[model samples]
Target: MFIDEAEIEVFAGRGGSGCLSFHREKFVPKGGPDGGDGGKGGDVVFVGDENLHTLMDSKYKKHYRAKNGSPGEGSNKTGKNGENAEIAVPLGTIFREDGKVIGEILSHGERFAAAAGGKGGRGNARFKSPTNRAPREFETGREGEKKLLKLELKLLADVGLVGFPNAGKSTLISVLSSAKPKIADYPFTTLIPNLGIVDCFNYRSFVIADIPGLIEGAHTGKGLGIQFIKHIERTSMLLFLIDMTEQNPKKAFDVLKGELKKFNPEILEKPMLIVLTKTDIDPDAKFPKRIGGIPVYPISSISRTGLEELKHYCCETVLRNN
Candidate 1:
């Protein structure tokens, strides 16, 4: 399952209490306080794992907690600290608390401390003084931190495919890379984002992301909505794919651009290319030389027409931008 979002509660371990014992020996004349300090609690941490692609584990397990520290023992012996609880999540996962961004893990083996452990308490021996040698005062351990956090995962890719339903996005990616995404003639065949690593000449390659199709009201929760749109926010470039079979290609391009602009205007600032797909279906069909000042490339994934040129161009553009 491709679960991108999840909510979880984290609880840090509590510290142990201090011991209030007094020294008792057979030969010692004056036995002073011999209490030991408590051990510190454990923290809750989140680790980034590149191998993980979904937040399914976090979704199923909504709560997490660290081990608590042991209490202090007699004979000036301190308690053992609790073990930390580490939760592994996919890279590019963002943590939020109360609608505010807290932290994010973007690299493999990276860790983020979600909740902090409590401090240990002071032992009775620490209160010993000249006037009060037999001090009995001891401190209690502090409580650990608790948090309700939200996790959001965004796919990391070099290029993002932006298009409406049945625009041949999946078909292009399948031919360019080893990624095999479910493709059908119907709309909304791709319910989740698919990634493919397109290899260019000289062993150079770039990752491409194909998200769910967008519609005119995609920014307003229509069709697949903005759920999959955010996955492309981190992309270095955008590829606008249009179906040549559409009656009004210009209107389709405008609508796709408008939806992206409404969701996030910065997306328009990225390097982009306009691709008209299904050229083999209508070889004699005419298209604009340029759309919104961007060059257009018409290709047919079925017949592999113009695939090499498109692949080379995409690779060079992505490599240069990087």
Candidate 2:
């Protein structure tokens, strides 16, 4: 039920019409115009809620409309305004119209107006003139705005884990944080992205995201990688996880980098670290101390070897960058 994208239509309320009435009294022979003005319409607004993590609610509901204003009454009394329509959405939700970016919600309780209500019409009393005592002119109300919007949700995390299938990304994240992702020996085990909050010294914490594995040609929709790759765009740092038992760790690192660069070249500019996982499985295996000028950290999720050092480094690096 983790929906990331949805399409919906929004409609604003319409204004009420003006009332035309003539004042009449038992004693007076002729009374002037005593019309009342109409009330304004309501707007369609979207609110951000941090408790929500997906766009599932928007997926089922397609259309939203606000309440219409009431008509004006006699005796120069104005009508009541319509009620607003508010829709709750998750943080990091982006709204688009006709493939163009309109706005985004990144904080809790943030509101964005998708459509505006129409203006109210003028009453006949506003058209009273000294020369024409019995003028009966009245104005009509205007229509509200309507639009079809697209919603896209992107995860917000401090660090992103990048690696091939079965490269111990899930295992590493589980050990580093409290996230429990489905792990198996086969490829494409993780179909969705998982987020975890890693606590550091002094109650400081940072969020980490573990997305689906990436393979060669992932940018071309080769596997599940293309669908989940965009989830890493918000991360401040990246961790390149590689299997220490691989025949050539350097080639693996190169493929991962190539896929990421192909999807978004800007991702390469972010600060990154190379991590060799499952070190306990191959204690004697040899890996380069550094890959492509980036330092390496070898750790075993099962035995918890080199985990404290890695955690300390990640905490300090993320804090320093922030």
Candidate 3:
């Protein structure tokens, strides 16, 4: 039910037309022209709601429209303005126009105007002058602008856990944070992204996102990895977890790195922490450390081993980057 992308159409309300009428008085025989200007239309807006984590609501409903303004009255009264339409979406959502990012919503209550209302028409009352006693012409209202917008949700997390299936990435996230994701020994257990808030001392907090696992050709859509790879774009940091108990940890790490690189070169530039998961299988194997100069932390999420070190490391990295 966690939808990340959606396409929607938004239409602004049209302005009301002007009204022209002759003023009649009880005492006077004749009266000047009494015309009223039309009211302006309403706008279509989008607001970011932090309480929402998915774009599922927008999936079924793709079209949004505002109400039109009322026409002018005969008593020189202007019409009522149109009602505005507001659509709520998850935070960290980005609006695109023709595949290009036009706006981004990162905080709650943040709003963006998707379409502008049309302008109201002018009345004919101003035409009265010395040379021209009365003018019967009136202008019509202009139409509102319509737009097709594409919205994409990129989860905002302080830490993004990335690895292959059964790599204990989910276990690490669940143990480190308050998230309780479905855990199994089989591959591709996590099909969607799981978010959890990690609380530290002094009320410090951060969001961790655990997405589906990656495969060798993940970048080529061989698995669900490519589809969710964009979720890592907005993460402040990455936790690359590898199952060191496997025969070759280096090869696994390389495949994960290669997939990231293939999907987006910028992913390689992100701050990463290599974590060797399930160290309970082989306590003394520093298999992850042999990868290179990258920071490596060997920990067993199930046994609660080296958890403090990993937490401290993640927190320190986040703070340093901030």
Candidate 4:
């Protein structure tokens, strides 16, 4: 039910038509035009709410439309305006029009006008002048704007955790951060990415995301696909967790790096820290010397060993990158 992307159509309300009426009192006969102007239509707006983490709410209801304005009445009485429609979305959501970015929501309670309402029509009373005593011509109401919008949610994190399955990624995030992700001795336990906020000394805190592991052929829609890899592209720094207990730890790390390169070469350009996880199982395993000239660090999440070093390294790496 975690929907990250959705396509929806939005329509603003139309303006009401003007009324054509003449005043005819009991005493005063043939009174001048007394028609009232029509009210304006409603607008469509999108708001960002931090409480929402997924786009699942919008996925259920695709079409959104505002209410139309009421028609003008006689006796110079203006009609009521239509009520506007508001769509709430999570923070870090991007609004796109025809694949182009229209706007981006970064903070809570921030709102953007997606579609504007139409203008009200003029009444016949305004047309009455000295030249024409009984003018009957009145302006018509204008139509509102309609658009097909695309909403894409990208988790805003300071650092991203990326690696292959069974690399002790979930355990590392759970131990380091407050995010209690489902951890097991199996692969693909985490289907969706989890976000956690890691706080360091001196009130320094940064957001970390536990993106699902990527496997070989992930760029070609194999082994949980490359969606996990794409999510890491937005992170300021990447923590590549490799299972040291694997028979070929070097090849495992290489495959993970290769998948990332295939997904986006820019990902490899980001600041990366290699974490050799599951060291408790095989503490003397021969880890990789260098993958693309990046040094690897051996750590065990269960034993709480080398965690401080990894945390320090992550903090320094993030600061250096910034």
Q: Give TM per candidate.
A: 0.61, 0.60, 0.59, 0.57
Cα lDDT, model 1, residue 119: 76
Instruction: Point to the candidate with the largest TM-score.
Output: 1
Stretches off by above 4 angstroms in model 1 are 1-155
The per-prediction CA RMSD against the true structure, in angstroms, equals 9.9, 10.2, 10.5, 11.0
RMSD after Cα superposition, model 2: 10.2
Where model 3 places Cα greater than 4 Å from the true spot, the runs are 1-10, 13-91, 94-155, 288-290
Local distance difference test, per candidate? 0.88, 0.85, 0.81, 0.81
- Model 2: per-residue Cα lDDT over 1-322, one tens digit each: 1239999999998887777877888999888888887778889999989789899999999999988776676778777787889999998898999999898786688899999988777778878898878768876767878999999986577798999999998998899988889989998888888888899999998888898999998888887757566677657789999988888888998999999998788988988889999999978877777998988999999889988998888898888876
lDDT by residue (tens digit), candidate 1, 1-322: 1238999999999988888989889999778898888888899999989789899999899999998877776788888888899999998898999999899886689899999888778789888999999898988888999999999986578899999999999999999999999999999999988998899888888889999999989888999897667668767789999998888877888999999999889989988889999999989978788987888999999989988988888888888976
Candidate 4 residue lDDT tens string, 93-205: 88899989898776678898899878778788888999988879776667877989999997587788888888888898898888889988788999988887777777776
In terms of lDDT, model 3 sits at 0.81
The per-candidate count of clashes, in order, stands at 0, 0, 0, 0
**Model 2 stretches astray by more than 4 angstroms:** 1-91, 94-155
How high is the lDDT of residue 131 in model 3? 78
lDDT of 3 by residue, 28-127 (tens): 7777777777788899988989789888888899889998877776667787888889999898888888888788786688899888888777666755
TM-score of 3: 0.59
Query: Least lDDT summed over 10 consecutive residues: which range in candidate 1?
Result: 227-236
